[model samples]
Target: MADISLLYPKGKEVSTMTLTEESINDLSVDYIVESLTKDIYEKNSIKKILTNLTCDIDVINYRADVFEDILNFPELRDGLVELLKKLEDLRELEKFNKDGDASSLWQLINRLREIDGYVLCITMLKNILNTIPIKSQGLLDLKQTIEDIYNNGGFDILKKDIDETMAKAQNLKSVTIGVNLDSVLKPKNAGVISLNNFEITNSGILKNFMGFTGSKEELNSDEKVLSSHKLHPANPSLTRMKFGSAQQGANTNVHIDTSGSATGDDPLSQSLKKVVTDILKRMVKSIKATLQKYVNISGYSLVGLMPEIIFYIRFAELVDKMKEKNLPVCKPLAVPDDRVAYGEDIYNIKLAIKRTKGEEFDIIGNDITFDDEQRIYVMTGPNRGGKTTFTQAVGHCFLLAQAGIYVPATKFNYSPVDNIYTHFPADENDTVDLGRLGEESKRLSDIFKVATDKSLLLLNESLATTNVAEGVFIAKDVIKAMAYLGVRSVFNTHMHELAHHLDEYNSDDSYRSKVQSLVTGMKDGHRSFKCEIAPPQGVSYAKDIAEKYGVTYDQIKKNIDNR
Candidate 1:
């Protein structure tokens, strides 16, 4: 196995990624799996653990598996060790109230516990390693060899030899080891060594120094002796052994010397580094071996076991630790309401026109209420009135309520709707094989196909581009379709004829009433607009507050005057 120290030189670094409530809520099992896969790749352990695990599982199962792998990874092994260490630190910090907030940490723990398989993998690996007894004899041999080498003048001889070589080489009068004297030496010693005059005058001395001794006629005889010394441990014909176990021992000593010691500085820091490195190495080797066993026993391919192992291990450990400290872990469900009032309840804005300079502002009250039986409402008013605003507000309110947020209303009562369908005004310039009237009819047809009684439909100024007589006729057909389908809906239009038709239909005592009109009176200072709902009763000025914001009295007057 590769050195665990190299795998995790430092404990796994804690994630600095900040999580928000929105982000947490949006998380799905797929997201969790993808994240784990990414982390494994980043740690460079994906090929070792995750590649073989991907073949058999579906998306959710795959994610669960990857999560297991993360917990068992060596970096995370050290991280867990660090976490246990920090638990003590945290306890200490708690005494001083310096731990800041533990909510996020607790959340992390709970999420981990929710993934118990990952926890099991980690626990099992740790247990396996703990069960392996240390080799006392091998350790004793190592210690004894080190002690003998140091006590028997071996270190002193090596040190003296190195010191003498360095001192003598430092004063070489005219020679450089690897380069000409002028090129190798600094400016201060440029002329000290005469490289041009250097030569090997004593061939015998050179050959003896390099350990090559043979007659000039028998020079080739030494080559065979040297070759045999390299291949075999012993050769009697060889005066000096070219390679031996002693040389291997000396090479090992040199390795230790070059590697340097971990002391002469902060002893605690050195000890900590050694401890962490050793722990990480052990963790990596143990985890890899255990993971291999999982592959063997489960008969699940390597890739499949990878994610399952990672997720369960990491998630379980996290959750267990989180539970030990009491923290919030559960997610919230969606709320239901029907009568939406703006302030205390959810607020939704429909076509809420913002004011531009010189342009009138308008806000129609789309606030609606539905009981167990009521299905539809028909809103009627003249041109430039507040019909559209009311339609839009209703749409906005339903959307906001479904999303589980407070609306602008003071109080709201509503059934949770699965879909909100809208048939607002479409552009005349939009490319369509049929004209505006054909397009409108097609849209309504499409809506009737899927819309159920549970769906909320909002129709604004539907069929108004044609004559009032024909528009009301088409409008009545659309309403009847919605009623037949049992879909709850609100329709806004300028046709008073349709309102009258609905009134006459509701007047029959036998029919259950569904359509109602919001044609209240409008009072502008001393002026009063006729209220259609209660004839001769002045128009409710409250409706005009919305109109005054956008529709000017002049605009209404211009249309009425032309009619």
Candidate 2:
């Protein structure tokens, strides 16, 4: 009954938020998670957490403190890593015991194992609490709760008696079974003949091994002696087969129960285990009575915290690496108010990750803000001018900030969105049946179905797959609907007309969210990759590039005449 969580505050631990798969992909969440968790333990579990967002104001705030504690206090993180190791040991014990139907004896042993693990965990918690100044409410409460459990829960008594209980359980290794049959010669009742330290080996060839190793005269004396199976293998102890779930996973001798049916051919080993378990189950109950008090504090609960711990650990490590690279990674300010998200000097984190790999390239950092005046942006830019990169970067800032991790920005202040929805253009091939524009239209409609006024939307080149007029026609309505919903969106497209008419949506008093134009600017006839809030500069790059490269009519005519 130990109520503990790394993701939620003391009173709130029973909720979750999930982003659509399209959103997960559109934001490049998979790649970002992979970069964070590369070569780390429990990677997929970390990925599960990273992809599933939580918008709870309290939970997100709790996690932010927890992450800062981990990032700032290396001693705390080291201590938690030790705790994680103990948790891993506990998990191995559970995994070992999970594959079989536990008898009373095995169950008691399992309980003892749990008590031992819990004791170690409690001691580790005490050490962690005593040594480190844990700032986060999550970790502070966790260690405090564990100490409370130990001090008041009679765990001290359990610790004092654990050694005796474990030794008592381990003594009942082998049982001598004597089955009683009815008059029809079928099993009616069974009882243990004795509990022996050693089992009687009765292989087909092992009744007498002296004849094979004896002198020639002795071999002749026992002339009727016959060889059955090979010479009893090597050693009896080593040759014995594993029973009742001790699997190595890939082999039959492993601890896991691969025997699907209870009816097995081994009368002495396999079949007898069930009967022995039933007979002695009640007898071991008294011996385990002392340890059962703390069994409610299942180690698996502590094991459940593994994913959360790994999430923080890996992100902290990623942040540490980025710090080493001199990239600014700041803890985001989680604002509760609506219709506002602001970030400064924010670059694509994917680009930041590449910087760590010794790759040389200049990353363009851009500033953006969303408010009533510019809640929705119609961005037009030159091709390969970082329109998509800048758009994706904005989504990343919101996502990483909302998840309570440090963002790849110098500073970011944001209110938590209920969820972020993305409509990054899909593969044209996938739109064959619905047609590219039709499929995209349906997709955008689907996003509007769940998006709220507080949601952050990033649309990368929506509706630009067809002719500009048609694409612009639908794109304008999309912007209008966003205005009506008061949702914050970044709509980047090549359709200049789409970016041209921003006041049309803002002039309508019914629409609360205003649409504005943004563009990736050009300097010295080269794409600057800097995004700014302005009227659509509209990519007239064909004329500019033609003029720069001397492909314009006057320049070409002058060159021909001179030639």
Best by lDDT: 2
**Residue range 1-563, candidate 2, lDDT tens digits:** 24688887877856656888888898888788788766455778876777677777788888889999999988878888888998988877787676565555556667677777777787787887778777789888887787787787577777777767756655554554543333533333344445554434543222233343356665334412222111111122322444222210110110212111222334233444555555565556756676756556677777888888888988898888888888888999887777787889898989988888778788778888887678888888889989899889988887887778999999898887878899987886888899989999999999899889988889998887647778888888899999999998888888888766766787899997988888888776788999888777653666677777899899999999999
- TM-score of predicted model 1? 0.36
- Candidate 1 local lDDT, 340-375, one digit each (tens): 222122222212111111234332222345643445
Model 2 CA lDDT for position 468: 76
> How does model 1 fare in lDDT?
0.39
TM-score of each: 0.36, 0.82
| Model 1 spans with C-alpha error above 4 angstroms | 1-287, 290-347, 350-367, 372-374, 382-385, 429-431, 507-513, 525-563
Query: Which residue runs does candidate 2 get wrong by more than 4 Å?
Result: 38-41, 167-268, 272-287, 554-563
